[model samples]
Target: MEVAQGLCGRGALVTGAGKGIGRAVAVALNRAGARVTALSQTKADLDSLEQECPGIQTLCVDLGDWEATEATLNTVGAVYLLVNNAAVALLQPFLEVTKEAFDRSFDVNLRAALHVSQIVARQMIARGVPGAIVNVSSQASQRALQDHTVYCATKCALDMLTKTMALELGPHQIRVNSVNPTVVMTDMGRLNWTEPQKVAAMTSRIPLGKFAEVDDVVNSILFLLSNQSAMTTGAMLPVDGGFLAC
Candidate 1:
């Protein structure tokens, strides 16, 4: 009996890879023997990541712009693994949510994912290759959170989009799935969940009574991107410590 290989010699593209879970996923994929390309809007972050993890190719692109993102991806080599992790969270009360904020969130969170996935999937189809895609979604996509009106909406839409992509791409042997996470203790997460009262309020709802680490989500992304989840698609795997189960 032969064991299955995991991501060795494959080409991977991770969006929003300059920070937090995205950065961790890119490094993990590289460690697993994939040729990795990390894409982000911040050049400084990309440079720092490239320095820390030698051999990781970096690209700077504002994913919100479809034209720029498409053009940039066209210049890169074919991608077998893609992580649509780029997102912007503009927190506002439902009544206070501005049109600008809504449009901006959807532009990067939903539109950019579609634009990038189409490009990658087209390349995969043309080359007659099997591939995988993981969309970095959120528990908020299923459950409502305070002041997360826009973010939740975008994620819900993304989940639906994931389903549609899986449906269409299945014939081409392309698997598409999403990983939904609760509050992860990244710099942004620490900043948002700092107040003890707020932290307690949120954690009390989780059966595990804790927040997620960046690696918690990153490991799940790796599993979906790797051959281990070959038959899985259109599924929303939660790294939310029972938050969604509650």
Candidate 2:
């Protein structure tokens, strides 16, 4: 996936960069010449990523710890781009959902995004640098899935969070938006979607008759983060294979 020019040397931060979509985005940003800081709870993953992208910076933090996450991000310099891609999916039926599962999911998915964005945005305001933030929401946010009650709720809340951020941060020229993808073929996706019955159930509903690959979602993120979508903010860009259209 290719990103726009003029991003070189600009500071960018991506959370949950240890694996899946977040890892891909961090690498893409680095290749696009942005000075990237990749944050995740996994140190080994960070080490591997740093080796792959020699100049990339990586930070290890458990985003569930609100104070620690806040403190850790405060150490970073001004960020021109931020991707709140860290999330946890606690798959439980609606009636079986527990308070612990709900709290943990929200803390990681929604609350952490708010904290990181607040810090990054304040820095941008202080430095007077325009910034862009992309939150990785999901298709489940719009549609109710059988066992994704908590995950869906968090994403739905995240979409609203993105909009409110766009409304408030617009004056500062800091754009915020969400990229909602259908089942992505990441490792996690494969584990969850590879079963014949499950695959058929989902892909049948998608006009393209397929689940999304990591690159499909990555390309959409590049557009939203780059100047190509300069006028886009508070918009939900679906990287699904027209899955929502069904």
Candidate 3:
């Protein structure tokens, strides 16, 4: 089979790559001919991705655990692309939020990306290789929705982190960008927006009149990681079906 050459001979690490947008991104990268290292907290998901793509490495590690994340990156080489797609969402009112919940959201959604980027950036810098880091964010970062304060806050922070990292790492030839998507049709989405009435109501708000698919998010990440976007950095690309524009 002749694979695409955009990322051929390149190595990539995609966090939370067991399912949904993460899984789709991993498959996209693999189809583009990159050697992918898929990381997720679920052993079964990782095993599944490994089965789908023989010789692909799968690591089961909770990104919330900083030490374990650091250890996992040590074994990998200088990567051509790093997708910080691991995240946790909390849909609760500010008054209902607990300190533990807040911390967990920030830790997993923001701090984990920081830790992984640091390790990956170090390797890239040391090896003097040009690379890209694509952070998976959300439309919630820019818009305030009911019962999504915590999730929105974390994504907002992630956007800032992307810019700061881009500034600091640019000289080292490391590009940092973000992909913000609206409600994606994933397991999580089904749990939150499965009702026909609810889906219709939400779709009405989006200018595009529908929620985004997992592939919509994956394709954007792939574009940012590829040389086609060599000049792009620190950009928060929205795959939100005009949700933010409305």
Q: Which candidate tops lDDT?
A: 1
Q: Give the alpha carbon lDDT tens digit for every residue of 3-70 in model 1.
A: 21568889999999999999998998888888999999999999999899989999999998888898
| Local error of candidate 3 at residue 7 (angstroms) | 1.1
Query: Local error of candidate 2 at 99, Å?
Result: 1.2
Global lDDT of each candidate: 0.93, 0.92, 0.88
Give the Cα-based TM-score of candidate 1 against the true structure: 0.97
Query: Which candidate model has the greater TM-score, 1 or 3?
Result: 1
Q: Indicate the worst ten consecutive residues by lDDT in candidate 1.
A: 1-10
Note each model's CA RMSD in angstroms.
1.8, 1.1, 1.9
Tens digits of per-residue lDDT, candidate 3, 1-246, equal 222335777999999999888988888888888889999999999888888988688889999998888888788765878999998877788899999889999999999999999998988888888999999999999999889999999999999999999999999988999999999988877787878998898889898899888878877888888878888899999998898898
**Weakest 10 consecutive residues, lDDT, candidate 3?**
1-10
As for candidate 2, its clashing pairs are none
